[model samples]
Target chain A: MAEKSSELKLLSAWFSPMALRAKIALNIKGLEYENVEEDFNSKSHLLLRSNPVHKKVPVLIHGEKSICESSIIVQYIDEVWSNNNAPSILPQHAYDSAIARFWVSYIDEKLFVCAKNIQDAGKSDEEKKPHSEQLEEEMLVRLEEAFNKCSDKKPFFGGNNIGLIDIALGSFLPVLGLIEEINGRMVLVEDKFPGLINWAVNFAANPAVAGTFPEIDKLILFGKTLLKKMGYCL
Target chain B: MAEKSSELKLLSAWFSPMALRAKIALNIKGLEYENVEEDFNSKSHLLLRSNPVHKKVPVLIHGEKSICESSIIVQYIDEVWSNNNAPSILPQHAYDSAIARFWVSYIDEKLFVCAKNIQDAGKSDEEKKPHSEQLEEEMLVRLEEAFNKCSDKKPFFGGNNIGLIDIALGSFLPVLGLIEEINGRMVLVEDKFPGLINWAVNFAANPAVAGTFPEIDKLILFGKTLLKKMGYCL
Candidate 1:
């Protein structure tokens, strides 16, 4: 029955998938929240005050509480809006939820950081090639296994619903696509990983997540500007 | 009223604080489980098969299911044994649980790892000095903040009971002492972090965790042997 709150705000950066996870979670919860975009170089006072631990983006503020860590924020949103119309983001079953949580934890713990490093490696950056390739291959292998293990009949990871695992992976979709675009490689090839490719396609087109992603061209251009700003690319 | 499982096995290592988390969880739950210790130099078949993602120890096998990730396994234990007569390891309230999780996550994500690197950097290793020093100071500052924020009147992070946060940090007690012994610096000095030090002492003396830790001198010797084997020390 908790459809709305007096004050719900998200401190985020447009370019971050981590931030996108919070936005997408809010959108899915059917809850109205103000999204305040942040500049990394000159972080806002609210951002610094709210998130002293990591000083990171995607800090969710609910009433007087400030929740950092995007995954935790999503969980908070799900819990606070437990009576919302949407199906439980993390399934009701404990085991199933744990599995969903494991995959979500896997995103930042291993997958996303590796993917970012791999995507950031310059085309002619020979020194970084093998390291990036190794991580990418390992990531793909795990993704392929998870894809095969989850339902092929259903459109999402949790079967018949876009559950927590779906949101966790779905948030990273734009970045995955951006990496593929920048690196000019078919990271999610149909022949090699048909199940994953199918899942990605379904996820990208899904209403909850689809609108959240920027156009591939726009994402690529934005990525370039961001990287240039960081002095990682010229 | 289920007191135990017929087929509960813990795949773990003696040296790993991560492994100890699972052991401590099992103990606190009062559920009978077998401890199958693994040799780190040559991991057992079950360790590899059960945890293909990390291929690490502390994988809990219950009936036919295998649960990996120390914290995840602990969470699973708490859920599966929810009926057991022990108080919840993670706090019951959502915000409280989130705060507990935040601290637990901070241990591995920042504090423990930085402390390890700082402890491992040899006295003559001038190249590693500045980085280790910076990370150590930041970690200490953060620890002080978390300690002060989580508890003032109680000995544990959850205020009286050894909750998830306590277990997470308690497992690192021996290693912390060992780190100080090696580096010859009192990272947990009473004046600097009195709250954490108090919690650490109370945790070590508490029956729940006391039985879980090795003797201080024995642990020191073990740490030396392990570091020597790994070429981290002479």
Candidate 2:
């Protein structure tokens, strides 16, 4: 099918997991879009006008319309590009779709909150390591169960394809890598969360997202800068 | 289309606006469900098991499947009951549906946060009256614009039918009423937010959610009790 004439533009920021979700979705759907990177400190007028409510990055502009919030943007991409030959990001079945949405919410609300807590703990990596790992372990165990339930032994949450949950969680791979590096240990233990560990590896290796992540070094630098900005020493 | 043989069960609490959303959606779709009211102090095992993550109410059980989260449950109800001869809760078009979802999110995250802050302010009604009114007024102006954009002069966000955004914001009418009553005078001033004031009236009067609200006196009592429990003087 020929791509629609209306050009798609993404107002995004580097090192943003939310923006990465939109990038991966467009890649998976085989859609072409202009990725206009936005500076976090001095945001462009387009970003402000496009997402006036949140005024956040990762606003997907399609022709005259702009969709904000990463998960919503991903869904918009999937729905608007339904005629494309690429696999749909959301599950086709209603029940499965609900389950996918449920876990995606979990990742955004629960999982990422834990990540932020760890990063903002303000203690030396050694001081916060045990508590941080424990906090994440609880969430990881639940996510492992979720991975088993949602993936059903398949390689991806969408069974054979990269789906919403995959994109939502996988977008955090680089940031999680930065956290792991800063903490000097792995939070995603292979023994405790085998399914998720495998899923993470597969997700990063997926063609749709293989090249989507920022370099780990860049992520680490960005994390430090952010934490410093937030008045956290570490 | 025949109704599914499996019965629908909703684990909900009487005083919860979140639970009210599920009720309104089921009502709009003309779906009959057994609403098992849960005690706030001692939640049911079914609710805990169905929604272990949040351990909250408004879990919709259909045969073996249980859907947690109010918005997810509403969407599930819409999809599962697609064959029913009732108006759809979500819009038909993709972009319109996304906009509806965005506003629903705004109501939940932004509008409701303002409501909770007013209720938990701990000041005497007279002391907090102006501040509470101002806090709610700011959100109301944005909601007024959203109403105009989404409803486009129609009676409801769903264009004369009760839709997702309507259920999302409408469920809080009684609570808003409670907040208004406690503050002495109205938060939703008729002059400032004519559309929303009229909408609040129409939404409460709708057959779907007409009799769903708890009595205002009972709501005030509940509000005071909750505030006291949270160590707020008011």
Candidate 3:
């Protein structure tokens, strides 16, 4: 029963969590959209034209308007089509919304860097010794605090439904799991980050999140391939 | 005309452009707030408790609510006191607001680094060579594009009044000016960045900007002192 709504197109990459954020948000809202996977080596004209600043992926085109950056795009999508029956991504209260946005920014600013470093280090044996371990310890402590902050009452960052913060952080779960699997180590284990672990499980098990998240095996394979590319493989 | 409304207090530092952003935003909004200048060496408990995550100022304390991150605090200030007579710092339109926020983020993520490099270089002879020159070129091109993007038909980033992008970028003006003064060269000349230069002049000349910005001579002194502290100068 679609009647000429604004066309939504997402320029995404399979393994990129940033693109996964856009993907999950769209699916959660029950919005019908076309997904065009961008080649990592050669970006499309649309991607470039849409996001000339960063020229990166996860560009959401709603008719003529193209919103770049995953968090920004997610907010835009939520605002533009806000009449959805799905749970509100951003909190209703201004302060809560601010807090949500802050966490989302924090994930990008802090946690993402640590995660990337761990991923890179996992690929490299020499650097993986004590450096990655130290970062992992720091990451765990921070994530523990963050989990306590976000999961004050409920399973998710916003308490009830999968909110903005949830979407932002959850997108990286598959890759993180893959990293743990490859390294034969536990990252966000239940003991240290109980709330985060529970939230991750709930997020992964959701119907909306079903097909959106890439397979763990596929991600591990990609990670291993990257390691090989970097000339550091078993 | 100060009513017993919500108590506003800004946890700030003079040398920090980020803190300066919160100051400018509060001033532009005509919001009466207490400014608690933080000593970089010994950070106050209020700043720590208020902003537990970053533990950095400017933390805007309105009542018991503590907002951290300068840009986020600026946005919060705009939203909270939105009914004020002051022109809206953020644009009304969704897309425009996104673009405004994007440019502000750009200023932080991109321009701020180049600026820091130039500022440091200005303080030392060793860094005055090709290193700072290369950074200056990059900064000019990126900033030129940023200016063009933000300014459509008006002077300020949000067009008419000083907007989010303006506050974010303009916070560095005093520091930038001091850098130019120390180097004996103009950083943002009219010819290279006419629109930006014009905007900067208008921004500095504005009454709201006055008193909030640290004096140029004092800033230069601070820069030189910092250089000395870093052992770059005798």
Ranked candidates, highest DockQ first: 2, 1, 3
Best by DockQ: 2
Against the native complex, each candidate's DockQ, computed on alpha carbons, is: 0.60, 0.71, 0.54
Which candidate leads in lDDT?
Answer: 2
Worst lDDT run of 10 residues, candidate 1 chain B, spans B119-128
- Candidate closer to the true structure by lDDT (higher is better), 1 or 2: 2
lDDT digits (tens) for residues A99-177 of candidate 2: 8899988888777776776777466767666657655767778878888988889998788899998999898788678
Q: What is the lDDT of residue B25 in candidate 2?
A: 90
- Distance from true position, residue B69, model 3, in Å? 0.3
Off by over 4 Å in 3: A1-6, A121-126, A129-136, A227-234, B1-6, B120-135, B227-234
**Highest-TM-score candidate:** 2
Clashing pairs in 1: none
Cα deviation at A27, candidate 3, in Å, is: 1.7
Clashing pairs in 2: none
Candidate 1 lDDT over B21-54, as tens digits, reads 8888887777778889887678898888888888
Tens-digit per-residue lDDT, B1-234, candidate 2: 534435789998888899999999988888788889987678788888988988988898988898988898899889888878888998888888888888888877777776666776565657655557556656777888889888989999888898888999888788888877867777788888899988988998889988998888987887777756855321
Q: Return the TM-scores of chain A for each candidate in numbered order.
A: 0.89, 0.91, 0.87
- Say which docking band candidate 1 falls in: medium
Q: Estimate each model's TM-score.
A: 0.92, 0.93, 0.90
Candidate 3 chain A, run of 10 with poorest lDDT:
A225-234
